[model samples]
Target: MQIISQVFQEISPADFFYRNKEIAGFSNPARAIFSAIRELIENSLDATEPFGILPDIYIRLSSTGETEEEGFYTLRVEDNGSGIPSEYIPLAFCQFLFSSKYKLKQTRGTFGLGGTMTILYGQITTNKPVEVLSSTGDSKIYGYRLMIDIERNQPIILEKKVYENDGQWHGTIVEVNLEGDYSKAKPKVIEYLKQTAIANPYANIMFVDPKGRLYKFERTVSVLPPQPKETLPHPHGVDVETIYRIIRVTKCKTLLDFMQEHFHRVGRQIAKSFLEFAGFPEDTDPKRLKPEEIVKLVQAMKSFNGFLPPDASCLSPLGEEILKAGIMKELEPEFAAVTQRKPSAYSGHPFIVEVGVAYGGKVPVRSDNDITLYRFANKIPLVYDESGDVSWKVIKSIDWRRYNVEPGMPIAIIVHICSTKIPWKTVGKEMIADRPEISREILNGVREVARKLKVYLSRKEKVKREKERLSVFLRYLPKIAEFSAKLAREEKVPDIKNLLRRVRRFGEG
Candidate 1:
């Protein structure tokens, strides 16, 4: 019997993602267009917030072909933010998994795949290079037309130009052409921008659609949320692969020094104790550790006690005041309440939860009798996968009746979770995993705001009842007064207006 040989080959990150575009949320033409817009806008927001600047973002979509589904469209997005350095433009747009966001902090894009994947989709569909113009507050602005080398996972620069700047221009502008269904994607894209405005209140976003329809979401405030701080990994969350990578890259000579340097809340004493528990010498070189030693170190870190829960300084949660203001500004609700939960942890990564509830006024009732839950992770809106998210589960478990909310009530619930690392259940980054600690924090936050809503609703009901009672008394008071006047043999009916006024004052008091 003859045996056949098997051939194996390694693939680049770009090639792999190109073959499986669905994982990055570019499964269809309409979704690809929406994803492209989202990625570019999110990148702009991330860039501007770090500088504490109110973002001014502009987006334009124009069709270059006939049919909507089979048409090619050009999308241009420009932002007023801290621009990328000229040297990094190619790698930033053309490469995959090369991101400055790898640090432990609350950021919008987690995997560093969104921006590049968008361009990759455009390239594969329309065979057009992406154009990027940027300036880092320098004397000159740089422009480049580049394409991705999928197999090499690198940028292939086609053209480069430089222009003298007036010192006032600083931001990024990206333009790409892709086959898309703008007609189908128009509503979703607009909704995304609108929700983004509500979540960010400090951003002014303007969009020009394929039909030349201009839409603008103006900023409501000048204040920006606090930027998230970079943090070290927690010992409890580290595994064999993470340990190996840390050991390989660490500059510390000794195992104890490496542990203390790489992990948060692990000081000299904690590191020494951990080494002792792992049966390793404190002064042993971390780079010389064998595989077995690494496994023991990971187990020791996991089982070790006395290390404080991971520091929460890395998270940047929207405060209750800001969240409520945003919800009211967007929904125009008659009553609104917001709560920010204290710091919590899941798998040793610290996180914070915030929730807001808005009722009545412009808030629309759902026809399906489902609560309107606006979910956000790390301040970025989660538009899809509502039923699969942990926040949705928490919402379903809530008894709306307890808050005096009914099936067709005009209410909106907003939830935001900020963490160094969000537990996303899918590669698309559209849904969050149902971690128990995260669920508890979300539930508590929502319940806190719901209690406030209950009070408001109760007061509203009381006022309604008072008005009804006053109406009934007004309807019957004249007849009663006439009868009493006749019985008393008086020629004129008694004036009860004064009595009515006094009664109203007493009731109000």
Candidate 2:
């Protein structure tokens, strides 16, 4: 561990964190497909906004190869989402750690990690470039396609072009050439896209395969997931520097107003309550409060139990309708859809979950493989290897066959959280590790959902099968008709034949 830390310390910040070869190489073709598509998907989501205009995304897969080559492929994703402004084009393609939206819990581009990684990976693997065309509201369209240096982490501009446009329209078009085997990544890509579609059903997605095949996933509904509320800095959440700044700029002469402004979920009444708890008067002027009174306010704040739930309005909720749209769009529409779940608590976390179950759809049957489960933390798709995931263990423990769901046949669930910190193991923000405590917490959370669904489906399937059985019995009547006609021709049992003839005559009558 010491050696590891020493080696880590020796590496430059960029080499150590942003452009690590090992981290970049962890993306196989399957994972790469997901990463590439997710980058574009987030862009699309950002474009379609509070205006409620349903965004249209088109994915075109062209086999850049005329020959029988498997690796030469180009994938294009075009979206009518809010396009990148012409001025920010360079920053959008080149910048990392800007994370302007990082503090935002609801918006999509928290890390600015996903898109930049795609550009980096494509540059490294194919030694090829990527192209991006973006337009702002009523702005001229700017197109940029470039490759970045892995060692230096800078763009090697391959193309800088623009399209004439008016400000009335906005969107982004991105295309990349990758060296990995596109065919093998097809199913995983399809599955990932399908889930993304279900999750964002309000958005329309179109995908084309390298074989010139096309797939389009769109949301039929116009309702979008709610936007995250604007956040105010919480005093407890602030660092020392920020706290000092607030202290310097505070206009209210007392600590009471300071509490209301800096801390989250605490209102003026709550701040007043805290002051009273600390033995200060409710009407005490904030600017005139004594230093001792301020200390009391701080003490009362630490003890207050009724502080409004962490101003979660700043956190976005992935509505049930949108999630299902995301799923049905990418995957086959034959799923048993459950949109949103009531908010549930776990380990002091306040989260809302939306689950979609596809029993037997167009999903493939695997070669004795465990079922493929896609796990997302805070709406970000995680690509960690499945073996280490806690959800996979819970999945394995249950007998999936009982639900008429085979290992490979379109069987999966989705979990979304709205908390400050997800309990995921890595910064990639994918799956939860298989620690017993966390595993138990997640399993328990999903159990109620599973139990209710299982009972509901079991009864539904039983009724369906009973109808099928009756239909099967009805099929024998035709055979019986043929046999009765032969008996009439032979006249083997005169009395029995006579009775059958009478019955046939009655049927005819």
Candidate 3:
């Protein structure tokens, strides 16, 4: 056997802290696109909250140069909402892997890692810089602009420009250059923009191509999504290491007090239950417990009953109305519906789901092309490849042929789910838990909407068929008139054609 000491060789700092440096350094182009878009979206959502304005967001896409590898694409996203404070510019724009927004409840970005990754992605792809223009309510602009190095994972401050625009400045504009074949990624970029417009019906968006083509999406509603709530950590969720550290370091007399100080959502009811079950009084000195007693108490704490479920007070979600409006805007449909599932308790925390679907018309149901499927855990859209997402999986399993949707006809569908613990499959946040319970909930909710859609389509088809039959009968009227004229001229046939003409005229009349 190898020596125990040999296995514990010296390790470098870079080895542990810079893990996944490539991904952290510069992500793939498609992922970068996803990242960039996500950053702009997050900023827009932030602006729309609090003041309760239906968000007005704009996305513009343009390509420079003709050659594939030599070509360049720029995506510009602008949002007219609550702008960032001038003082927070450095922390909001330049900092890497840092987030000022964090709460215990369901939020889109708990880690605050997404936005920086976007700038990093652009830096890696272009080896250049990114520009930003942000302003608060009628305040002078404080733009903390910079260029990032992908290889070194460093930010280089470029220029800090003062604002000169005359209008009330309450928005931000972000522009970035990245190496991409815009021709290839154009469809996807457009689809994403349109879907975003639909999902955020309260937000107005506009896109202009490099060739001078423009696409604009405006919100029809006046309502904005709800603001996010703060969350608290679960007491039971703390590991053994955490509890041991707390017991050793805390000055509290009882375990209940320690729980209250360190853990969140832990009320007196739960503390009393944990103490009673552990055979400890509320006032028992935590320092007095022997090792055996501690073990017993820990076990009892684990088995404690009637612990209040995790409160969803901190969970924030964009309301169903707004989410549906945004979806229907891009995936225009004859029938569109949204369903928000009741809050569900999981591991003592409450979670919920909001699903939206649009049936009829062409929403491009093609396997070769990535279908415009949008998923938001809370209110943030997952921007990675959606081929293997839960919604895509459900789409693949469903029999679309029955709906008379020819192979690649457009069929738009959008889904959003909110929970304290999202079973996200990747850092890209593209896939969700494939477990039976989650899958079952998603499938059932979508199927109900699909059922209603199928009925609507079938009725429409029936109306179309009836119209065609009536048109065919109308086409015979002229021929019948000619025959009647011939019979009248022949006379020997007793003018049968005349009789037929009369009958045809009566029918026409």
Candidate 4:
């Protein structure tokens, strides 16, 4: 038997993502366009909302190819936020796997490939470089036309120019021409922006579609959500690789100092106790630990439950008021109920769930009798893969009839999960893992709001019945009075005005 030799080659991150575009939601023309718009707008939101600034974002997508709906389109997104500094522009936009979201904080765009993936997609599809204009609220606006060197995974700056800035206008403007099916992508893209508005009511977003149609979501709130603070990783959730990495980089001489400095909620005393429990001396050199020792340390840490619940300060959940305001502004529901669950930990990562239920008015009723669910994670809208999300799983388990909300009713449910580390089921970051703790909190939060909705619905039903009864009396009372007056030989009907007034008030109530 003859054996054939095979070739082995290593691929760059850029090349890998390019070959497997579906991993980043760039599987088709429609999805690619939607993902591109979603990525850039999310970045803009993260830039402003965290710093207590009211965000003003604009997106414009226009068809550039001969066919209006299909083929290449020019996408432009601009934001009024602290712009990317000039020096960091190229790498930040071009390099793959370079991101600040790796920190233990609630931030959007976790993988850091989101923005660059859009650029890479555009470059390969249309063979056009992206145009970027940025200003740090300074006197100069740096403009560039650049593309990624796919093989080397680097930025190729074609042109760079400095322009006069208004000084007060500080933000970023990114434009790219990419192949897309805008006609097919319109609905999902619009829904994404709408959900983004619902999640971040403090941000103003305006969009101009490929057809020149404009949609605006104005800010309903002025105050921003509390910014999420970065925290250290918890020992219980970390793996041997994480511990080994920390050990290699840590400057601490002893295991006690390393533990105290590296992990959260591990004080000096806790560190000493933990080291002892792990069969390591307090003065044991962390750097001297072998691979097997690191594995043992991780196992001990995971089994130890002495650590306090994670600090919730590292999370930024939208309070009940802001979420309610957002729902009211977008859905214009006649009644809205919102609640925020108390902080909870899952796998040692802190998480909070905020739920809002809206009924009647402008809330759209689906023909399929399914609830309209708006899901968000850390203020980023989860538009795709709705059925797979933990929020969806919880929603499916709920019996809406129990809350007096019938199928196909004009109702919308909004759920936001705030966590430093989201348990994403896929690299797409669209669906969340159904962790028991997260699901429980979501269940509780949704039930709380649903109960409020039930109360409103019950009262509404009573008023409806009252009005129906009043209608009958109103139709016959005057006739009855006239007949009675005629039979009694009176010229005027009995004065029933006061009685009618009382009945009218009751009906209204």
Report the C-alpha lDDT of model 1 over 1-509, residue by residue, as the tens digit: 88899899999999999999999999999899999999999899888987887899999999888755557999999998899998899999999998889988888887888999999999999999999999977788999999999999999999999999996699999999998888888777877887787788878899998878899888887888777788888988889999888877889998878888989888898888778877888889988888887888888888888677886788877787668767877788998888888898888789999999889877878889788888888888888779999999999998889889889888888999988889988777789999999999999988998999899998888887877777777899989999999999999999999988876765565
RMSD list, candidates in order: 1.8, 6.9, 6.1, 1.9
Over 43-113, each residue of candidate 4 has an lDDT whose tens digit, in order, gives 89878887777999999998897779557899999998788889889998999998867888888878989
Tell me the TM-score of each prediction against the true structure: 0.95, 0.72, 0.74, 0.95
- lDDT score for residue 342 of model 3: 61
Using lDDT as the measure, name the better of candidate 2 and candidate 4: 4
Number of clashing pairs, model 4?
Answer: 0
Candidate 3, 180-277: lDDT as tens digits: 54555566667667656665666676767667788877768876666546655565444456567667877987777865666666677777777776
**Among all candidates shown, the one with the greatest lDDT:** 4
lDDT (0-100) at residue 485 of candidate 2? Answer: 70
- Provide the lowest-lDDT 10-residue window in model 2: 6-15
Q: Tell me the TM-score of model 2.
A: 0.72
lDDT accuracy of residue 317 in candidate 2: 66
| C-alpha RMSD in Å of predicted model 3 compared with the true structure | 6.1
Q: Which ten residues in a row have the lowest lDDT in candidate 3?
A: 12-21
- Report lDDT (CA) for all predictions: 0.88, 0.61, 0.63, 0.90
- Sort by TM-score, top down from the best: 1, 4, 3, 2
- Model 4: per-residue Cα lDDT at residue 127: 96
Q: Give the TM-score of candidate 4.
A: 0.95
Tens digits of lDDT, candidate 2, 1-509: 36554333353323444445335433576566666676767766765753456778888766666652656667687877667776676566665544446563556555665677766666666777788988765647888877665456455666788767865667888888765566676766776676666556677778877666777665677776677666665433344454555566776665567678766766788887766666765555555545665555555555556565454566566766666555554556344455555554333234455555544455434566555566665565554466666676776787665555444454556555454445556545555655454455556545654565577667667767766655554565546666887878854422344544554554434
Backbone Cα, N, C clashes tallied per candidate? 0, 28, 16, 0
